[model samples]
Structure formats: C-alpha cells, structure tokens
Target: MLVKLGPLDAGRVADLRPYLDLVPDPRARRGRWYSLTAVLLICACAAVWGARSLDELAEWAERAPDTLLTAVGVRRHPLRWRRAPSRTTIGRVLGAVDGDALDREVGAYLADLHDASARAVSGQRRVIAVDGKALRGSARLTAARRHLCAVTHHRAVTLAQAEVGAKTNETAHFQPLLEPLDLDGALVTFDALHSVQANVAWLVETKKAHYISVIKANQPTAHRQLAALPWRDIAVQHTTASTGHDRRESRSIKTCGTADELGGIAFPYACLAIRVHRRRRQSVRRESRETV
Candidate 1:
C-alpha cells in the first residue's frame, strides 16, 4: 500500500478510490464478505493519519468512530453493528493480491492525474527526477537494507520504481528503472554519481530523452575540463540574496555556450556550462564562500 502521507487529500481519495476497484480480488466471492477496495482504502486512510505498522493500523481501526469506518466502506454487521476488518485480514488480502496488477492500476490513475501538468510546454521538456532511497521499515526483516531507484514526475508522483540489488549501487539499476517510463523528449535530472557516458548515451540515443547531471570529481576529466572553463571572463547572468534567522546567503551564476574556447571538451553532446558562486555569512563577519 504505497500511500501518500499527509493530511488526507479528499480530492485525491475521490480520484483514486475508483482506481482501487481495478485491483483484482484474490478471494472467491462465495465466502468473501470484505471488499478488497475497502480494505485498501482503510489502509490508505491509516497511512494518511500517520499509522506506521500493522499493530498501529489495527489500533487505529479499533479506535476509529463508526462514521469514519463506514465512510471508507467498512461493512456493517448483520445486526446493525459498527465493524472494521482486523489487521490479520488486511495483511492476508494485501499479501495475496497481485502486486504488479495493483501497481499498474495505480499507475494508470497517476497518469490521468498528471496528463494536464506533465505535458510538454511549447517544446520545453518536462522534468523527471531519478534517485534512490532506503526503504523504510525493511531493516527489521533483512540483514541488508532494501534500496529502490525511482523515476518520478516533477510533482513527486512515482511513475516507475525497482529494487536495486543489495550488493549493487543505484548506477547499475538506472536503465531498468527508467526504461518503463515514457521519457521521449523529457528532461531527466540525477546526481553526480549517475553522471556517466553510458547513461547519457542511452537516454539520448535509445530513449530520445535529455538529461541534466552534476559534474563532480567522480568524472575526473569532465570535471577538470568544465572547471577550467574561462568563467572569470563571463559576467554573472543571475544573482540572488536573502537574509534570515541571523544568517545571510547570496548566490551568483554565470553561463556560457560551449565552443572551441573550451578546447572541445571530450564529452558527449556537450553544450552550455554554468558556474555558481555562493557565499554564506553568520555573525561577527564570519563568512564562507564556495564555487561549483
């Protein structure tokens, strides 16, 4: 149950409840009294209200008022009693349901929600962020922590995700994580660790996508070449300054089109290079400056 945690978005619930019905029911109808959709909705509500575990979920359902249980479609007892499904029942249903089918249904719902916003605007590519995160609540069950690489929309709606091998880092799992997404002409952004030729090449040549990645010491040559650009000769194109909480911060940036002056940086599809200088100041004239 990959639920979005926050104050429950009533609109989101309404939009997604119908999609939940598409998840196939694993139980036979003759003996099954509980609706699978209702169970998922109850779990969704539990997550929204900050329940973190099975015990907590059961406790929440037991404590919930009759109105709340009924609102999420919990079945009424035949004698007109208020009732909710037990944690054991929730666990069995979720454990038995086809996870892939559930993900597909949810993905379809998300795509509908994203259609208006994720569309390309005047040929400008929409952004998708790729990153890995440690799965919460997995440590108790495994010797190694489970980590996942996810492709998400700019609004943080997860489009596709896959578990990375415990022995491997996110780099090796990048292609698989992104291949399922519709990335043509989209701009994908990732961190320095994923800035490699193979990734950029596949995105550009195979997927017809654009990418933005950080150049750090991990890619020594590109970092050195980009770092050696004639940044001092270029004027700052943008600048911003703000002061708050007894601290002051300022940043200025310079960008220049790549050309022969950069000595033809040996990087694929080299384009513009940018430099940003930042300064932070605390009390009593203490200051720190860094450039990247």
Candidate 2:
C-alpha cells in the first residue's frame, strides 16, 4: 500500500506554512477540531494539490479527512466528521488571506533557495531571466486582465512572482518586482520588450545588476544610432570561428584603433558594451561555402 503524506511533504508547500501562520484574520470562527492554522494549511495544501475552485477544496476536506487531519498535525483519532467547511467558508478564507504577504513569503523562499543553490556553483554571480505569464481566467473583470511577472534564475526554478492589476502595464510594474531581489553580482536578462533604457538603467544603478537586453524596433532611435556607428572600426576586437572536414578552420577578427566611434551608443555612466559574432561550418569528408 502506498502511504500518503500531506502537502507539507511537497517542497514548495513546505516553504509556505510557517509564513501562513503569521497572517491574522479577525472574523475567523474555528470549528471544534479545526483552527486557523489548520484552515491555512488546508488552503495551502489545496493550492498545492491543484485545488482551483472552492468546491474542490471542500470536497477534499470531506473525503480526505485522514489526509487533512494529518496535514493539520491533529493528534486525536479521526472523528466521524461531517459538515466540512462549505464552499462559502473556503471563499471567505481566501478573500481574507493576504495576497501580498503570501507573495512575499513565496519570494523569500525562492531567494533562499537561490542562495543555497548558488553556493554550490563556481561563479560569484547568478543570472535571472525575466519573463511574464498570464494567468488563465484570472482576469475577472471584462476590462482588466491579470498578469504575473516572474523572474527565474538560470538553472533553477522561479525566483519571484508578482500579480499586476488589470489596468497596470507590466513594464511599469517590472521594477518593483525586481526591487527586492538580490541582484548584486547577478546578470539580469530580458527580451526586447523590456529593453527600455530606464529599466536597464535601474537594473544597473539601483540593483547593481548587470543586464543583457535584446534591442529591437520598439526603440527605433536607439537601433538607428547603434547601427549608424562604425562598430567594425573600433579597437574592440572580436574573433569568430568556423570548422569543416579535414581539420579546416577559419577565423575573422576586427578592431577599432580608437574607442570613440564604435557603436556610438550612449550607455549609462560606468556601463560598457561588447559585441561578439561567430559562425561554424562542418562536413564529414569535405566542406564548401556558397556565397552570393
């Protein structure tokens, strides 16, 4: 027989309980065997168990009494219990739960996990990939849509998440989500959509984080200015390599004798840019290049 444990056994679920206990609810009325702590545990466990609706949670509470009791750390023998929390009870508790506080706890857990994992690696820094995900059906109002902005450190799970209101643009909320994270000695990476100069500046200056943001047409002026400059003529030298059959190889190099004209990009103070390019070609017994 497979013995079952509770959501506390889950890695993410274990991280949430301690903080959930600290949340205060004044109008909470406890049942004979159930307490506020148990209620939160139920909710957290339900969330971990993929309980998206209140009826599902209530049904779990009724049918999985043993599992629920064990999860709540109940010592007494299971009673012939009925009248598990109604769906209304579940909804009320959810409404009372502090979303911001829960978000902070989840963020803290991720930060701790990141720190622990980083200690095992060789580098002195970490890389955080910034991305956004829309919660399906989370947008309740016809006019507002809910989106979650998340940061995931490379080679690890999610590091932090924040829910934005329907009307708030995600780019405007990106900084605040980034503000509490430990970005020192870290490299933050984002896509062209988040390549705002102000955002990049904040990552470097405010968070002390290095950034690598892709440039695209949204910033037409910046793109034009970058392309117009003579980067190929600068002292900044880059090497690219190509390989083929019979141990054949080719490499191209470039240099700017002076630093003034390369890219002509106005980076924030104390910031620098390096451009790299590479090409590779290989075949079993021979190699060929088709050039126009």
Task: Report clash pairs, candidate 2.
Answer: 233-256, 234-255, 234-256, 235-256
In model 2, which runs have C-alpha deviations exceeding 4 angstroms? 1-15, 26-37, 62-88, 154-158, 165-167, 218-221, 229-264, 269-292
- Candidate 2 on 157-256: residue-level lDDT in tens? 6667787775666788789888878888788888777888888888888888888765667878756655565665666355445445545454444432
lDDT of 1 by residue, 91-174 (tens): 888789888677767766765555545554555457788898877776765466678787776667777667788678899988
Error of 1 at 18 (Å): 5.9
Native RMSD of candidate 1 (Å): 4.1
Which predicted model would earn the best TM-score?
1
The lDDT of each candidate is: 0.77, 0.63
Against the true structure, what is each candidate's TM-score? 0.75, 0.65
Report the C-alpha displacement of residue 185, candidate 1, in angstroms. 3.8
